[model samples]
Every structure is written in C-alpha cells, then in structure tokens.
Target: MFAALAAVAIFTGFVDAIAGGGGLVMMPALLATGMPPHFAFGTNKLQSVFGTTISCANYTRGGLVDWKGNWPLAVLVFVASASGALVVQQVSTRILAYIIPVILLMMVAYLIFSPRMNDEDAHERLSRVGYTPVAGGIGFYDGFFGPGTGQFFTTSLVALRGNGLIRAVGNTKLLNATTNWAAVLVFALSGKMIWLLGLSMAAGAMLGGYLGSRFAMKHGARVVRPLMIVASLGLTGKLVWDWFVS
Candidate 1:
C-alpha cells in the first residue's frame, strides 16, 4: 500500500508539475486506504503543498516566474483560496460542478487545436487591476472545488494576459503552490492529515516535481501543452462522472 501510494504520488507529481489536477488521481489511493473523503482531501492538500512548492521553486530558478510584479496577486490568491474553503461549506456546488467540465473541455480543445498557441508572449491585455479578478476567481475555485486550478491560471495567463506557454506554466506552478498552502493550513487546523503517509508521498512527489520541471524547461510547450490537455481531460472526465452519478 505504501509503495503504491509513493508510485502514484511520483506519477501525479510529474503530471501536476507539468499540468494540474493531480488530485483526482491521488484521491483513489487515499480512499482505498479506507480514509474518509474529507480526510483524504486534507491529506491530499498536505502532500500536494510540497510537490507544488518544488515545482514553483524550479520555475523561479528558471526565471520563468515574475515574483516581484506578481506578489500582490499571490497574496490575493492566498486570501481568496482560504475564503473559498470557508465559503464552500455554506454553498451548494452541484451547478458549478456540472458547469466546470464543459469549461474544461473547451479549454482542452483550444489548447490542443489552436494554431495560434505558442511559447511567445503576446500583447498584454490585462493590467494588474484587470488581473485581480482572474486571480481571485480561480483561487476561490481552487479552494471551493479543488480541480483544474493550474490549468485555469495558465490559460488566464496565456489567453488573457498574453504570456508565453512556458512562462505561463512556470507562473502557474507558483500560483498553485501559493494556493495549496492556503488549503494546507486550513485543512491542517481541521486536524485530519495523515502525517506519516502524507509526508512520505510528499517525498516521492518532490522527486517527480524536480524531474518534471526540468523536462518542461528543456522541452517547453512540446511537453507542457500535451500534458495539460491530458490533465484537463482527466478532470473533465471526473467532473462528468460525478455529475452523472450525483
């Protein structure tokens, strides 16, 4: 069981470092261990924080991240993500859940088929003020529903902010790492984490994150774009399944 968890973490960490939405992949392993859904969620957050941070660090080292200019947005993401976690308990997400897969499917199609897509920065459409809403929207979604946050951020950076795919992916890792911490702290305080296992999986994730970021840096969009499509499709499939059964 422990070996299976570690192997899955390595794979998901690789996928997550390149794309996002590894949670759907990780959850089944946690559930198979007889963990309650909420507990599995918390443990997932706990393990993911490490992998995300590693990926973010690699991106920063590669100079793909713009921390000086984007720190405020990071702070905004942290606040909004935590707020989303709090607000989720008070809301019904059935409609939102049903809608998100459609959005993801469209995003996957565009990213995969768009001839216009490239690793070149284009005309910046949004100023800092304009991007605030985007940051808050996805951050809130990250905490509220917990899937596709990285893809949402990367797409916004590319389509809305006109960032290059590689840079957008790097920045996505930074934002996601920031977003994960908010969930981690919130879930930690709830006292549900399985520390030994979480930490062990996290160790495996670090190995994957490091290797994945390196591959992305070397191959650029060639690697990231397809993996993102896979991740988005994976999330879309999960959401569609949940909507059907629920």
Candidate 2:
C-alpha cells in the first residue's frame, strides 16, 4: 500500500508542480488506503506541502517567481488560509457542494475553449489592494477544501494579473505551497496528520515536482493545457461522484 501510494504521489507532485491540481491524484490515493477521510485529507496536505516546496524551489531556480511584489500577497494568503482552516467546521458542505461543481466545470470549459489564452510573460495586472481580496478568498478556499486550489490559483494569476502561463503557474506554486504548509502546521498542532503516510508521499512528490517543472519549462502551455483539461475533468468526475455517493 505504501509503495503504491508513493508512486501516485510522484505523479501528483509532477502534475501539481506544473499546473496546481496534484490533490486530484494524491488525496484520493491516500483515501483509497482505507484511512479515515479526515485523516487522509490531513495527511495528504502534510505530504503535499513538501512537494510544493520543492516545486517552488524549482520554479524559482528557473527564474519563474517574482518574490519582490508577491510577498504581501503570499502573507495575506497564508493568514487567510489559516483563518479559514479554523472556521471550516462552521461552513456548510451543502454550500460547497453546490458551488464546487460549477466552479470545476467552468475551469474545465475555460481550459478547453481558451487554448490561446494565458500570459506568456510575467507582469502584475492587479494592484496590491485589488489582489489582497482575491488571494485571501482563494487561500480561504484552499484551507476549507483544497482539491482545486492550484487550478484556481493558476487561473487567477493568468486572468487577474496578466502573467505569462509559465510565470502564473510558478507563482501559483509559491502561493499553494505556502497555504499547504500553513495547513500542515495547523493539522499537526491538532494531531490530525499521519506522519508515515505523509513522508512517503512527500518523497514521491519531490521527485515528481522536479521533473514536472523541468518539463513545463521546456514545453510551455501547449502541453500544460491538455493535461490541465484532463485533470480538471477528472476532478469534476470525482467530486460529482463523491457528492452523489455521500
């Protein structure tokens, strides 16, 4: 079981390192191991944080990150996500259920129809005030339910900030990694995480992140779009099925 999950984690890291939906792979794999659902989610976050950190490093090394103006946004994202984690028990799953499908479907549609869109360079289109709310909201979403956080972050950077696809993805990695780390910390404090599983997944994710980032830099959005489409549809299917079954 550990070996199987570890393999999945590597692919999850690679995909996530490039485009931001690694959870679509890793979380379900963790859950399939027969752990409790909440434990699976928490442990997935624990492993994912490391993969994301590795991805962030890879992107930064590739000169894809803009840390100077982004720190404020990152800080806001971390704080808001932490707050959301604390308040998630208060939010109704019914609301999330109604909203998530729509959002996921929309993301899938965008990836399919707008193949030519996505910035090819790095430039900030949103002012600090303008982006604070966006980042905070997404961060909150990440904390509350994180399956699609990376896709949302990637889209936000592209649509709102006019970043090139590569840069947008790089920036998304940074933000998502930070949020995952915050969640890990909180979950650890609450004794909600499974360390052995997390470490195994982390190993896979790190290798995947390295390879995926390198592939993205070489291939660009032309490759990413199709994979994004597939990942989005897969996630939509999973969520819809889960929603129905649960």
Candidate 3:
C-alpha cells in the first residue's frame, strides 16, 4: 500500500508542478488506503510539502521567483491558511462542493479563450499592495477546500497582476508551499497525519517535483498553459462528480 501510494504521489507531483490539481489525484488515493477523510487530507498535506518545496526551490534557483517582492504575500498565505485549517476542523466543506466547480469551469474558459493570454508579462492591472488580500483569500480557500489552488494563483497573477506564465507558475509554487506547510503544522498539532505513509509518499514527490519543475522552466508557457487548462477541466469534472455523488 505504501509503495502504491508513493507511485501515485510521483504522478501527482508532476501534474501538480505544472498545473495545480495534484490534490485531485492525491486525496482519492489516500482515501483508498482506508484512512478517514480528515486523515487523508492531513497526510496528503504532509507529502505535498515535499513536492511544493522542491518545485519552489527549483524556481527560486532558476531566477524565476521574486522572493523579495513576494515574501509578504507568502507570510499572509501562511497565516490565512492556518486559520482556515483550524476553522475547517469544526466546519463542513459542503458549501465549497457546490461553489468551486463553477469557479474552476470559469477558470478553464478564461485560460482557453482569453485573447490577452500570452507567455510574456503585460501591463499590471493590480499592484503588489492590491494583490496581497487576493493571495490571502486564495490561501484560505486552499486550507478550507484545496483543489485548483495552483490554477487560481497562476491565473490571478497572469490576468490581474500581469505576470508571465512562467513567473506566475514560479510564484504559485512558493505560495502553495507556504499554505501547505502551514496547514500541515495545524494538522500535525491535531494528530491527523499518517506519518509513515506521508514519509513514503514524500520520497516520490521530491523526485517528481524536481523533474517537473525543470520541464516547466525549459518549456515555459508552451507547456504550462495547456496543462493549466487541462488541469482546470479535470478539477471541474472531479468536483462536479463529487457534488453529484454526495
């Protein structure tokens, strides 16, 4: 079971590095291990930290990440994500089940059809000061529901903040790592993680994240944009299915 979970984590890490719907793969796989939903979420977060951290490091080392400019947003994401994780322990996510699919579908449509979409950075629509709250809000969503977080972050940066696709992806990885680690800390305090399983999966995620980040860096938007669109559609389908089944 551990080996199988690790295998899935590898694939999830690869897809997640480019697109952001990695949880769509990881969560169901964890649940199949016969863990409860809360345990699955917690363990998934533990493993995801490895993958996101590797991807963020790759992006940072490659000079794609603007650490100095983005550090404040990263801090806000950590705080907001931890708060959301704590709140989620006592609340139902049923409402998000209905809402997130619509939002994801909209993202897919925007990615596919937006004429302004391009690989290069454009004129900024929102300054860093204006985008901070947006980042924090998305961080909260990640902690509470967490499906297409990478897509949301990437899209907001590109469409709103005028970042190029590659830079947007780099920043997304950093922010994701922030929220993931923060949520993991909260889950750890609550004793919700399966340590052995998470560690097993982390090994695979680390390798996959390295390879995937390298691919994204080399190929840029030619690869990332299509993957983002595909990931968005996939997430939308999964959420709609879950809504129907529930």
Question: What lDDT tens digits, residue by residue, belong to model 1 across residues 185-204?
Answer: 87777776788888889987
Regions of model 1 farther than 4 Å from truth: 89-92
- Model 2, span 1-246: residue lDDT tens: 878888998988998877767887777777777887667878988888888888889889988988887888898889877877767645554577567878989987777776434546545578768988889999988887887888888877776787778888888888998898878877777777899878987899889988998998888888877777777778778778888788
What lDDT does the true structure give each of the candidates?
0.86, 0.81, 0.91
All candidates in order of lDDT, best leading? 3, 1, 2
TM-score of 1: 0.94
lDDT measured at residue 109 in model 2 versus the true structure, 0 to 100: 79
As a whole number from 0 to 100, the lDDT of residue 158 in candidate 2 is: 77
Ten contiguous residues with the weakest lDDT in model 1 = 85-94
Of the two candidates 1 and 2, the one with more favorable TM-score, higher being better, is 1
Per lDDT, the best of the predicted structures is: 3
Off by over 4 Å in 3: none
For candidate 2, report its TM-score: 0.93
Q: Please provide, for model 3 over 185-230, each residue's C-alpha lDDT reduced to its tens digit, 9 standing for 90 to 100.
A: 9999999999999999999898889889999999988889899998
TM-score of 3: 0.98
TM-scores for all candidates: the values are 0.94, 0.93, 0.98
Candidate 3 collision pairs = none
